[model samples]
Target chain A: MVGGGQLARMTHEAGIPLGIRFKLLSDTPQDSAAQVVNDVVVGDYRDLDTLREFARGCDVITFDHEHVPTEHLRALEADGIPVRPGPDALVHAHDKGVMRARLDAIGVPCPRHRIVSDPADAVAFAAEAGGFPVILKTVRGGYDGKGVWVVRSEDEAAEPFRAGVPVLAEEKVDFVRELAANVVRSPSGQAVSYPVVESQQVNGVCDTVIAPAPNLPEELAGQAQELALRIAEELGVVGHLAVELFETADGRILVNELAMRPHNSGHWTQDGAMTSQFANHVRAVLDLPLGDPRPRVKWTVMANVLGGDYPDMYQGYLHCMARDPQLKIHMYGKDVKPGRKVGHVNTYGDDLDDVRERARHAADYLRGTITE
Target chain B: MVGGGQLARMTHEAGIPLGIRFKLLSDTPQDSAAQVVNDVVVGDYRDLDTLREFARGCDVITFDHEHVPTEHLRALEADGIPVRPGPDALVHAHDKGVMRARLDAIGVPCPRHRIVSDPADAVAFAAEAGGFPVILKTVRGGYDGKGVWVVRSEDEAAEPFRAGVPVLAEEKVDFVRELAANVVRSPSGQAVSYPVVESQQVNGVCDTVIAPAPNLPEELAGQAQELALRIAEELGVVGHLAVELFETADGRILVNELAMRPHNSGHWTQDGAMTSQFANHVRAVLDLPLGDPRPRVKWTVMANVLGGDYPDMYQGYLHCMARDPQLKIHMYGKDVKPGRKVGHVNTYGDDLDDVRERARHAADYLRGTITE
Candidate 1:
């Protein structure tokens, strides 16, 4: 797996029981996955030589992030290396403009969007879309709300163009809430979709994810799964594919963004689902039959533990374990830093309210936000 | 952890979510836990220098097995190292004679037993206990059916005497079945016990374990748990302690043996319990609050996957995964050899029969005992 972040850290863990030998191409020895994964190659993913060296003895190459240069991946594929969610599908995740154009061509429900040449082009597209508040995003290298701007007028759009990267102008989605449809696909075209989850964001970083998107009509949930699975097939994605969606107030769902690998939105599956997304991703990449994606409990709430006032969360574990003995905590093995996702807590039970409160309390307590 | 075997491998996996750094003192880099744990010292654990170096920065010293020398542990404790299940408690697990004597002193129910000096002494004890058949076990270094003998006569009893280790002779248990009572304890005296489980032994090696021991009278089950918890506290065990027991036809429970670390009997907790035995072991050794020990489902069956006809079990993963998507497979990084434990599968659900069959089938399929 390329990019040894928390996603790779978790995928490496899921691979252990399957007896899969993980060869991680990490940026440094201190990267989250590198700290645990035995066979790790610390190198830059952009360098073709480094990618080739890392793929030498690997059966199949996969990624934790979509930031790997497309040309480097193509070179590996040219050399007969199997890259799951190959360069073609991964490019869409790397560039928002490409993803928007592909989704529009495929008739997938997406917000009105266009590739903007400059700040003026963004303003014109916003005017055509009947909006003053537009979302401007760099076509490449944006994540976790970075390289994204909510522009209410032409004057506010100038900042994004100054970075000099191509920008995509999108009509601000009038959504009631955000949802994620996570699915995994194998090279044989077999696919499995997890339940749609309600994702609550704090300052553009995901703070909590409630599985099954409470109160979502059954038919709509089925439609969301169908859409996500169709997208995986259409894009020829061979691993996990997360479709971030906007649940509009008009009772319709529109595509917001796409992640070709395991995304933060699917983290709840680690403890909630019969088969975690990380495990299925490993299976899909290996072209093995996937495991079940059914929820293990009636409800599961996952809350991200961002590094906050407490630099040592271990000090809070005693209280958390005593308060909620069933809560599953997953730490990323990273140094604590304010506003960074260092871990997550998952609580599952029949009572959604109770589960949600337990999860919130644990995450908050670990962050030192709640003294009690 | 003192030993780098499957128990340590699993404990390391459990500690990952808690951000616990495991420093393994493995005999080789290829040891099961050594392959995954980052801070590893590949050295002989029997050497005082090696043990001292390994214990330098560790917060508490613990073991995956009970074979660590009592003298070495005492020295470590003398130097102020926190040796959980310290020498005094660990010696009982290391020696069957010691365990029997201690249990007898505490009035714990055990079989008619005595430390015999020779074959004649064993024969005399057996004759006095009302039978020709007698069970003889080495006082130290026995595991997985080894160092144990069931002798029916004086001629058969002579073989164990040649080993030169002190032998404990006991009246062969005339039990309907074997059972295990598992419990974990913290240094603070807090303890939690899992339900008693029926353990099936094939050729004296554990083949399967059914949690809650199907149809066990509630009162008997409660007694078994209470016995195990009392044993943990009485021994001052600061980590997981598994009490192997014999459930006689007369509805009496007798102590068989003890393990001061994670045992095969509790493997089902990986997927069946609210908190796994390995996780609780880490917490207990760290003196942190313990987690719940309740079963997550009505029934759980765990079947050990012994290395059989197949050298590569990964070949059967696709079939087993597709056949039972909910089956949780845990494979130790070990080369396949007949009669060796390579992994185990867990199945849990409302129906005991279904869970049992699923677990059995998965284990058999992985071992290549069954083609389909």
Candidate 2:
């Protein structure tokens, strides 16, 4: 396992009962899961010797984060360490430039884009792709709404590009909603897709995800799932693949980005689906047969807990538990920061509205904006 | 945590993401979960000082097993540590005599029984309850299939009871099937009951559980659940309460026994119910509102991997995973022995028969009998 955040924490948790031991690699001594899992190798991911030591005695290597350099992964694989979804496939998820180029090559529809290494290139792309309010994104290592910005004027896009940052410029999409299509693929080429979810974003960070993408047409949902399935199979990824989608006003679905591991959008599956994305990720990487992706309930929703204003948002934990008895809160042991993905809550039932509202309410309570 | 075993292992696993710290009481440095959670205090449950050290700074005290003496638990409670369920309620589950007597006093119907400390008392009770074929059970410290005997003739029952064993002689139940009703109670008096499940016992040890008690009348299931709810409420238990039910040939439900924590019968809920029994137990003990007691699917079946002829069960784990993609196996970190509750596999789907067979097949495979 890599990273000691909640995702890794949950995976480690699930593996323990099955008698499958997991060793977590973390940078900080206080990494959430490391506090509980004793076999932790504490070191920065960028340190080659640290990574090498961490990979020792491991049958196969997997990750909780996609931040490791593709070259570093390649080095491990070259030394005969079995790294699932190998570096070549993982690069599409780690770097935006690589992802865009790969998706385009596969004829997957995406937002119009341009690679901008200089300020002039950004300005030129903005001029050609309809002037104001274009999006500028870093080519690598951005997550949780970070490393992306919007520019309304030519001057606004100049500094970021001129700083010698390799950026990607794309036409700002006027989509009706953001949908996430999640899938898991095994080393044996088997793949399964979860129902597309309608993701609600607040300030570029995901606030809530409603499974089955409420009110989405059957054909559109299938198309989105097919796109995710194609990516996982084509990339030969051996774990979860989360495809963020832009559901256009005209009902077309466009790919936004991809994550080659369990993604936040699939958190609802923890309580709602027959088998969770975390469990599937473990099986996929371990070369086990994939479990069913069909959900246990009719509707499921997941809401994230962003950084709260309080020092300890735990005060609401009790109230949230009391108010929404069915809500499943998964809090990541991390210092609360503005816009940080601290935790999430999952709620599922036949009533879509009830689940959605309950999930949001618990999330709001965690954020200290609402009280029971 | 009281003991560093599989239950504690999974609890620690669940607590990691929420940043909930636990102090495990271990007998050895590598007592399973202790191998993962290093923050364990090595000592026996019989030691008060060690217990105090483990209890201090803990948010809420719970257990991994019921072997901790009731007196020690009371002492912990006296010292202001919040021991869930408390001694007064836990005694019923810890001692069979106390449980039978308490159930009788509470007006819950059970088998005609009498406590015996000698051979004379057992012979008299058997004669009164219809001679011969009586069941002799030790009142305390019996689990799995141990410490129980079937006495067909008076002579067989005489010697065991003469040893001052403190036995219970009861009319053998002529039950059509055994069922388990699981309920969770909060400290604040709130409670929720899950659907009754039919338990399959092989040689006095539980081997399987079928959720919703297949084809059980709605009224009968509701009655069983109500009985469980009433018992949990009356007992003032602040956690899970698992009531084993004996469905007699005459279609009557009788209380067989009680367990004050997550039971094997409820394992199906992990992948089948609205809220997992473990999660609900956590919620109830923490005094949080109880989760819904709704089954997510139409059917769910759980089969135990008991101590059987299986010697190299680990070798079969891969095959089981590959064979049934929907089967969920939970193996405890214990050396498998004949008649031991080492692990379980749960499967759920729309078709009850298919799910049941899948669960049974996986369980048999783990037991070293992979016969088609």
Quick one: RMSD of model 1? 1.1
Instruction: Locate the minimum summed-lDDT window of 10 residues in model 1 chain A.
Output: A13-22
* DockQ each: 0.71, 0.56
Native-to-model Cα distance after best TM-score fit, residue B1 in candidate 2, in Å: 2.3
Candidate 1 per-residue C-alpha lDDT over B1-372 given as tens digits, one digit per residue, 9 for 90 to 100: 999899998898888888777789998888888887778899988899889988998899999898888999999999899999889999999989989999999989999999999888988998889977989998998899899999998899998888889998989889999999999999999999998999999999999999989889999899999999988888999899999999999999999999999999999998889899999999999999998999988999999999998888888888998888788899998889998999999999998889989999999999988999
Candidate No. with top DockQ: 1
Q: Least accurate stretch of 10 residues (summed lDDT) in model 1 chain B?
A: B13-22
Q: Please give, for residues A154-250, the per-residue lDDT of candidate 2 as tens digits.
A: 6787756644558999899999999999999988898889999999998888888998898999999999999999988888888899999999999
Among the numbered candidates, top TM-score falls to 1
Candidate 1 is scored at a TM of 0.99
Candidate 2 chain B least-lDDT 10 residues: B13-22
Each model: TM-score of chain B? 0.99, 0.94
lDDT of 1 by residue, A6-70 (tens): 99988987877776677899999998888887788999998889999999988999998888999
Where does model 1 sit among the CAPRI classes? medium
Global lDDT of model 2: 0.83
Q: In terms of TM-score, how similar is model 2 to the real structure? A: 0.94
